[model samples]
Target: MANSRVFLAGLCLVLSAAILVYPSRAVTAAPNSAQPKLVDKDAQESIDKGLKYLANTQRPDGQWYPSGSYGTYPTVMTSLAGLALMAGGSTPESGPYAKNVRRAMHYILRVAEAEKDGLIAGA
Candidate 1:
């Protein structure tokens, strides 16, 4: 119970940070609407917060909840994080999360090289 509370608190903090950081990326218009309408800023803020939290809470090795103590955690984390970064449009060259994406990609690649079957190729 205590652990759950801690986790929830962390999640909330991350979400708040995202809303404060990226206000513009909150929403997209629904298709086929007869009238043009803007999205809710507060709701968009909530979504951005969630994304930020997920990104922030990722383990250093790249995985969210990695298992296997013998370096497997790092491998798994890297693969998972790399995929997540990619989904967020992070790349080696540019984008808000370029650095993180590059790092995760590198980590996953290194793990793959070290042990071919150790990590999943795709997150």
Candidate 2:
């Protein structure tokens, strides 16, 4: 129960950060001017690399770190990682990290389906 609360808090923080750092307003801005100023080239590259690492590290079952330090919070990690990919402009339907997004979504859905309740479990 306590773990779930902590996970919820952390997930909320991540979601809030994502919204602020990657606002929808930036998407409509001129790519040649406003967009470039919001994030630098190197920072963007680093983000790309990190997303790629996350994608590569995903389990064949569509989860990440399912039995390690993050094992206790599979749903939280998956949600946060998926949000990060989305914040970087990738969706399950399109974009560079589409596969990752889709995989995470599928995993989450599977977990939800297996559970009697709507809430996802941490373990």
Candidate 3:
């Protein structure tokens, strides 16, 4: 439960950070905006690298396997990775990572379908 809380907190942080990176398309701000810029080049670069790592590490099954002790947490990893990608401004419908996000969702749905219970614990 503590781990889940931590993970959820981290997810919230990522989602909030994304607001600073990408402004809302639906609601445009005024000319005298307080926060005009997204993220700095360095921060953006770091985000890019992190996103690239996730993209590269994603398996064909749309799951992510962490090294070492956390190897068994593929379901959680995939869920988090998908959320992270969404936080980075990519949706399952469209974005730079649209394909990756879509694939991840597909895998998730597949797992859910196979499980008699709705709990998605693994691939």
Candidate 4:
């Protein structure tokens, strides 16, 4: 129980730090500039592609990178991926990737429930 609290507290701290360090909008050329428009389009495209990849790779169990080295850290990877989805403006309640977000949440909750210790440790 204590470990779980510590882990969750740490996760919250890291997330808070991330939000403080990275603004939603990237620093780019002036909005009226053609270069900035192109840059924004390219960035959006890259983000779309990345999100699509993540959505496609998600397991039925809602975990990601469930094999190889990453398999050792399923909870961490899942949380990070979920955070990425959220950073992209998707939430469990709404957004383009809402379903994915919910799945991740459910998976995490299930894991937490199954474990006597509340800690979300890697399998």
The 0-to-1 C-alpha lDDT of every candidate, in the order given, reads 0.53, 0.71, 0.73, 0.72
Where does model 2 exceed 4 Å of error?
1-36, 66-71
Instruction: Please tell me which predicted candidate would have the highest TM-score against the true structure.
Output: 3
lDDT of 2 by residue, 74-122 (tens): 8778878888878777767678887887788777766765665546754
User: How high is the lDDT of residue 75 in model 2?
Assistant: 77
Question: Tens-digit lDDT track for model 3 on 1-123?
Answer: 444544554555446546635669777666675776778899999998999899989999888877877457777788789878888888766678878877777666666656665456655
Model 3, residue 71: C-alpha shift (Å): 5.0
Highest-lDDT candidate:
3
Model 4 misplacement above 4 A = 1-39
Q: Please estimate how well model 3 matches the true structure, expressed as its whole-model Cα lDDT.
A: 0.73
Candidate 2's TM-score reads: 0.66
Candidate 1 stretches greater than 4 Å from native: 1-31, 34-43, 58-74, 116-123
Query: Tens-digit lDDT track for model 1 on 1-123?
Result: 444544553444345435434555446344676875555778667756755765676656544665556544555565555555545545555566666655555555444445434433443
Query: Candidate 1, 85: how far from true, in Å?
Result: 3.1
Model 2 clashing residue pairs (backbone):
none
Supply the global lDDT for candidate 2: 0.71
Q: TM-scores across all candidates?
A: 0.45, 0.66, 0.68, 0.66
Better of 2 and 3 by TM-score: 3
* Order of quality (lDDT): 3, 4, 2, 1
